[model samples]
Target: MSQVFDYIVVGGGSGGCVIAGRLSEDPNLTVCALEAGGRGDGTLVNTPTGAVAMMPTRINNWAFDTAPQAGLGGRTGYQPRGKTLGGSSAINAMVYIRGHRSDYDGWAALGNEGWAWDDVLPYFRLSEHNERFDDAWHGRDGPLWVSDLRTGNPFHARYREAALQAGLPLTDDFNGAQQEGIGIYQVTQKHGERWSAARAYLLPHLGRRDNLTVETHAQVLRIVFDGTRAVGVEVKQHGEVRTLRVRREVVLAAGALQTPQLLMLSGIGPARELERLGIHARLDLPGVGRNLQDHPDFIFGYRARSTDTMGVSLRGGLRMLLELARFRRERRGMLTSNFAEGGGFLKTRPELDAPDIQLHFVVALVDDHARRFHLGHGLSCHVCLLRPRSRGSVTLRSANPLDAPRIDPAFFADARDLEDMVAGFKLTRRLMQAPALARWITRDMFTAHVNTDDQIRDVLRQRTDTVYHPVGTCRMGHDALAVVDPQLRVRGVQGLRIVDASVMPTLIGGNTNAPTIMIAEKAVDLIRGVSRVAAQPHNDAQAEPHVEPHANYAPQARTVEARHAIA
Candidate 1:
């Protein structure tokens, strides 16, 4: 006899943790959360700087490599998703951004009702407990904690000065009245430690709640369907396959890459792909693993003259040791740095409706998602296209459940995205040349003497890759290709819901973590049949943004290059 639960949340990731935690709040509803990785309670997860060690290695990470992309000149991109309980939140840079307000409104425009900026703002507020702000825009009491960086580094001011010198506006808050400016990013941290989604929602409720059962190393092979209804899951835990029955729903929070893979593995994806793999098609949902979207990023690395920037050196090593001591004592120092210490939102051209590009100013030189390390102290600034017309997919490598899914983020498939990236690069390069930053830099690590649009395009194709935001595989919409409805229920199946980034119809305008948590927070209400109707925007929330005009960017932003296809 298999154990039963009212809800069986697959993948104890960012979304799964919230789903399980929220459902289990009712003593009557028994919820079980299954994670394929360990319990994510290690020092590596709690410490903010430990991500430097975790992201570059396979410790609690999936570390999957994509199929060779012709976009990056035939180079395979590295995707380091968190396999542990917190999911990517445990391994990510901990930058908490809710994208742009227009992002959610755009989703509503695409037939996803109740997802407009006004509709989702309540959920965003409901999930946050801000350390600084307590206004209409931010929540004062919530499960998740959002706080300013504890590292009082002098570079924060310098980064601000650099942006100002480059003629960008300033905003004290991104999740406030304005989001279109440069500012220090507020992180999902509390008291200098990383406050991942699981940490905020699940960890505290562990032994306190008898209705909640958190299972680690439990990998679900497939959803056990009773005809078209998902009634249970067949999971492999500790080398023993077990059937965990679900009384009400089988929710998948297995992230963008895996949730769709699980659907396909359960014979609910494209009929042609299932037939080729010899799996009987239970539900012919063609959009199960389609519509993959990500932020294709280009980095500008500069060797810094100052030793204060985080890097490997005798002087920096001595400083890090001191910072470690300070962290242990007061939880405030360079050890609390999230690497991407500074962030900005900008439009390549003044005519765009919203910011076309985003920036992540890393305190250290991060190469290949921090896989390859460089010597000496340096800083890196990442510029990525916020909304790429390019699309990709996540499909089955084989019929085997244990096999990794194929991820193909066909970057630059649309010629327009590359051109926008070129304009963004030039704008960022101008900031790098500003006196505030230029005085600290020795030389450029990449893109030196590369001026022309064609040269920029070639280098972009050679060097551009993801900034770790992947979404929209199991797209949520009313359209036929949409795997899930706006309510997040699987289209052709019953008792199955996807509550992760995969359900996003389109990638948001900024970091995805905060928005993903809001998705799960809203999903809980949907699951409980108590979902609120999206309210109108707050009185103060609807102000027009103050955008500085760039008369020169609009004309030269056009692409003169031909489209390139990946083989």
Candidate 2:
């Protein structure tokens, strides 16, 4: 029997949860959301400490690895995405950052209409129920809970003080009027418990509404297309295959890595690639799996002089035992910590339009997304290039949907990106060495010996990986290769839309979780025909050149040659 719904949301992730939950608000509509993973409300999914364990393993993570990158000496980089109802949000750092306002404006400038900061600001406010902030910039009543650090950990204050002592300015809010500065990061939590999109949006409506259906362990194979229109999806659940029909639209809320792979499997990708794989092309959308962008990140590790950091030791193990009791009683303790307690956006060059890099101060010594372990207590800091000229792709490993996509981030593909990272390394190293944090550091572990630009470049290439903010694969724009338009409608495919990070035309300055939820919130309005701004086909010549959405992309023209100016 074919299940039927007015709307079928594929991939019950951050975006799918919002899409299904909001559409269910209209009693007249029937919605079905299918997740590839288990229910994301388990103890491991809700506990912040569990994220540390999950990321290093496949507990609730896809734990995908990239194809060998020439930039990293032909080494494969780890890519850990959440494999649960909340998607990556369930196993993320829980940092509630919406990115810089200029990032959205940059999208609008590139011919994506109605996506400017001013237009998308309302959606950001609409999705957040902030616990501490209440102003023109924040919302007080919403599903997602955004709050200040509720734990008693004292490391965030020390990190911020170090950033300030290192000559960086302080900004209380990274999402406010000013986007430049260092401060304690706000998290997606409620009473110290992890508040993922599933908890905030979908879980509430699971049993409350018969109109909405959320199926777990249901892997979407491909879209069932009648000609060029997507009418349903063929899903495999419990070792059974079934076709679920959609009355109106089929929205792909899968993240950047999976969405394009699904589209390609459905015969809606580059015609040549599809033909070579023995699959008939339905739409020949050349940009389907192209334009992959992720933050190329490098972490600086150090041996801690104090016991404030999270590490393996007799004292730390004892503290953890006591924290388990404290957390069970009040949900507030060291167990509530979201390892990355402090972070900020900073500019490497004074001439750049916005911050070219971002900082994440961790309470533990993180190596390869915590895949690698170390002894004793230590701390680490991450410095990632915010905007890179490099662009990679997501292509099908095989015609089989069960197979993982071949992810090629092509980190530092553009030479300038490496240069900028070299510059960023110097700037970040100085901040870590500031006197405010010097007292806490016993010895530098990774980059202490790195001094020369060439040495920095060599070390970065050796250790650089992703900060897990991959976007722009199924890009939204008004170009020949665009997969979706500004309204998020798939090009050349009727009754199909992509409402996820895959549609991001460019990379945002900070964490992608908050912005992803906002994208889904705005997508709901667009789908209901209640969009505030009407979409238009833009071909403005005054705008920047249309950045290619493919494997071999031209470097951004704005990339400034790194001079030893600031250092």
Candidate 3:
């Protein structure tokens, strides 16, 4: 006999962990979580600096590659996702940031009720337990632990000084009243260890809850549907194929890239695409794998004069050994560093409603996603466009579920995006040239000689890639292209819901992890039929000024022409 669960959460990533953990809290309900990766409790996932080693190796990452992008000069970009219990959160740089207020308000403007900044702020507060802040804007009792950087490098202070020198304000809290400023970031850490979603919501309750079942290394092949309703999932576990029955619902939280792939593989995509792939159609949802979006990022690297920055050398190797010992004993020192230690938000134009660009100051020379290494110590800065107009899709490479899906982000397909990248490059260059940082820079390793707009564009076309924040594939809304409704239920299917970053109608203005957790936090309410009301008081002062949905600083016709030409 097959054991039945009231709820089955697939892919124990950021949203999966939260959904499973919250649903299992009811002693009467049986919840099961299926993860396609190993337990995320290893030392590498716990140590903040461990990401440096994990980025280049396939240790716990599904380091997939994108289809060659025309906008990127036919270069294939790298896409590394966490193949562990916590998913990408386990392998991500631990910076914790909630996007601008208008990001959620924009969702409301797009016909997603109950998702405005006022409505979602409570959920964000509910999921966070910030160590340094306890106010109406923040919650003191939550599952996720957010803290200040324990090992504050000297270079971090210098980065802030440079930002001020470049005419940027210093903000103590990026997640507070305002987001447009520069400062050291607060990370998802607990007493200096990485606090992944598993550590926050799932790990402590694993064995204690008898109704909760967690299956690791279980790969789900397809959704078992009875007509239009999702009833169960076909999974392969430990060399055996089986069906896990869901009595009430099945939540797909396999992330932005894989969630749509899972849906398409289950014969629930565009009818023509499914037929072409030789799969019988279960549903004819044309929006299943469309609307792919990601932040297009470019890095500025320079040789550093200080040994404080990370590098490959005998002296640094010896320091790492001592740091490891210190980490084991006190949980403090260089091992606690999340490489992109300091960053903040900025608006390129003063008239913009919210920040259009985000900066990440790194203590290492990261080339090609850390796949390429430099011999000497250095520092780098990542400038990523907060919102991009380009769109792409995820399609099935084959009918087999084991095959990786084809990803096309279509970066800079819209000319406005390229223009913004160029402006952002110039702005970031000014910050890098500030005396605080320029004093340590020995020589420019990437873009020193480039001066003209065409030269900058050429450099961006050759080197730009993702910052790992992809969203909007299975976007939620009431539009013709919306795959999921405002409640997160698959529009044409029953007993199925998507609660990951994929459901975002538009990408948020900052990191997506915290918002993804908030999605699950609100999802449990909808699943349980509970009336969820905002707990925090709303203030118009914190509200963002209204702006058009797809407003861009560039002339509209030029951008449209560029988009059409690229298409």
Question: Which residue runs does candidate 2 get wrong by more than 4 Å?
Answer: 531-565
Q: Using alpha carbons, what is the TM-score of model 2?
A: 0.94
Cα RMSD to the true fold for all candidates: 5.7, 7.4, 6.8
Better of 1 and 2 by lDDT: 1
lDDT of 1 by residue, 1-567 (tens): 239999999998889988998899899999999999998888989999999998978999998888888777898987889999989999999998998888998999999988999899999988999887777788868889998898887788898777766777766677877578777888999999999888899999999999999999999999999988899999999899989999999999999999999999999999999999999999888998899999999999888978779888999999988999999999999889999988888877776777878999988887778878888999999999999999999999999999999999999888888888888888888877889999999979888879888999998998899899999999999878999999999997899999999999999999999999999999999989886545756665465433333221222212222111100
lDDT of each candidate versus the true structure: 0.88, 0.87, 0.88
Using alpha carbons, what is the TM-score of model 3?
Answer: 0.94
Identify the candidate with maximal lDDT.
3
Backbone clash count, each prediction separately: 0, 0, 0
For candidate 3, write residues 282-379 as lDDT tens digits: 88899988999999999999999777889988888888898889889998878999999888788777768898999999998989999998898999
Residue 383 in candidate 3, Cα distance off native in Å: 0.3
The C-alpha stretches of model 1 lying farther than 4 A from their native spots are 532-536, 540-567
- When summed lDDT is taken over every stretch of 10 residues in candidate 1, the lowest stretch is 558-567
* Superposition error at 8 for model 1 (Å): 0.1
